[model samples]
Target: MTKTAKLYRMVMDKHVCPYGIKSKWLLEREGYEVEDHHLTTREQTDAFKGEHGVETTPQTFIDGRRIGGYTALRAHFGRREADEGGTSYTPVIAVFAVGAALAIALSLFAFGAPFTVRTAEWFVAFSMAMLAMLKLQDVEQFSTMFVGYDQLGRRWVPYAYAYPFLEATAAVLMAGRLLPWLSIPIALVIGTIGAVSVFYAVYIQKREIKCACVGGSGNVPLGFVSLTENLAMIGMGIWMLLRPTL
Candidate 1:
């Protein structure tokens, strides 16, 4: 006997239900032959909901048992639901991915070169500026998280607020290869402080904490990524200062 499932989802002119599509795809992936049904009109959807005594679209049934919505289907299949406040690297990964793409695009469009040392430079600067932008959105919240681990942020309240601005300014100037005298020192000082703080807190003390690198609203973990950000910043600073010699 073949396993079978039935799915009903909304497919409207303005919007198609994403969860509905996901449910159908998931059923198919799990080797279920799905009888896909689309509630094209609001009235039809309402009638179905009223008849089933349910409140949402994208209902699924397996072996004549009502399996609820997409989340419910995931539960039925024993997949872990994403915790809203759980630690994740998604935000940082997204920022880095976008920064790298932007760097490559800038290199190709402006300089007509695909791969250059400048591309690497732009990627670091762009990630720095983007991360700074995230922190600047909520300085109060960011400072709360930052002071938890950063030695300087704990000693000076103002440094927590000023850190984002400093990072952004240095990044913009460094990307332009302008005002190296000012940018290099700012980057080096902050980067050195950040790297040491992260190392001590996460590696030495074995303390688990949230990172302020992508701002306070995110749940990005304070570990390798936070260290990587600081090391990249420091590397960029040193490279910019000594590039003429190499």
Candidate 2:
């Protein structure tokens, strides 16, 4: 005999709960025969909640035992649960991966070669530009979060707000191969500040803070990833300065 499950979900005129849909899908996918019950009316939902002593909809039951909600169902099946405010490197990794690929593609198309020193320069510039775009999404939020660890940002609140624009400006100048005198200094200063901030926060202070590298909304930890990003910018600035002499 096949296993069976019961799902009690909300299906109101204004809103059909998304978790309810997910629960039903998960049950069916797991080869369980699901008997779905929709509490369409507000009164019905209220009564069901009161009787079950549960506050939320999308309740599941297996073999006459309550299986809780969507998260619970996932846990029952031994699936990894989504982290609640936990640190992850996924956002940074995705940004760098996409940025590198774009830089390589653009260099190959424009210069007819992807292995030149220009390719490395383009990669750093593109990555900085991309990162600046993320920070610019919500400058206020990013600056607020950034002040926690960045010494310069903490001392001068305005610097946090201006950092993204500065980074973007440097990136654009470098990418366009224009105004090297201004771009090199801007990249070097900001990158140096960022590197020191990351190192102090992660190593010296041993504080566990969220990185503002990606954005205010990211959950990336303040660690090696943040340091590496700053180091790459610093290296790019030095390379640009010395390229003319070499």
Candidate 3:
């Protein structure tokens, strides 16, 4: 006899709970026959919740025993709990990945070649612009968090607010191949400052803090990813400075 699982979920016309769909999929994947009970109306949903003595929907029961919500079901399967603190590198990864793809596409369209010295330049410029945009979204929040580690931001608070605009300007100027004298120095100075700040904060001080790379709200830990971002900018700045000479 196959052990049947019962799932109580809210499936109204205007509101279809996402957890309920996930719960159903999970139960099916686990080889359990699910008896789905949909609370279609508000009255039914309220009545069901009152009867079950539960506050939320998507409740699961296995073999006549209650298994609670999606979190509880995941626990029963020994899965790791999801962090609510937004402490994931997913946003950073997504931004960088998309920027790289866009850079490559732009390079291919402009130079008619996928791999070129110009392509690397484009990649760096795009990355800088994208990162700057993220910071600029909420400059106040970003500056507040940035001052925690950045030496310059700590001393001169306005620098933190100005940093994103500087980065964006440099990126735009470099991408346009305009005013090397201004753009190159801007990139070089900011990149140098960023790299030093990241190194001092992560390596020298050994501080475990959130990175303001993506935004103030993001919880990306200050470490290798942050260091890499600064290094990339520094390398790009140096490359641009030496390109004309080489």
TM-scores, all models, native as reference: 0.75, 0.84, 0.83
* lDDT for each candidate structure: 0.93, 0.90, 0.87
Model 2 TM-score relative to the real fold: 0.84
Q: Which residue window of length 10 is worst by lDDT in model 3?
A: 237-246
Collision count for each candidate, in order? 0, 0, 0
Off by more than 4 A, model 2: 107-119, 178-182, 201-208, 244-246
With candidate 2 superimposed using the best TM-score fit, by how many Å does residue 49's alpha carbon deviate from the native?
A: 1.5
Badly placed stretches (over 4 Å) of model 3 are 1-3, 85-87, 109-113, 179-181, 244-246
Which lDDT tens digits does candidate 2 get at residues 1-246?
998999999999998999999999999999999999999999999999999999998899999899899999999988899797787777777778887888888879988987667777777888889889999999999998999999899999999999999999999998877898999999899999999999998999999888898889888888887898889889988988878432
TM-score of candidate 3 on Cα atoms, chains taken together: 0.83
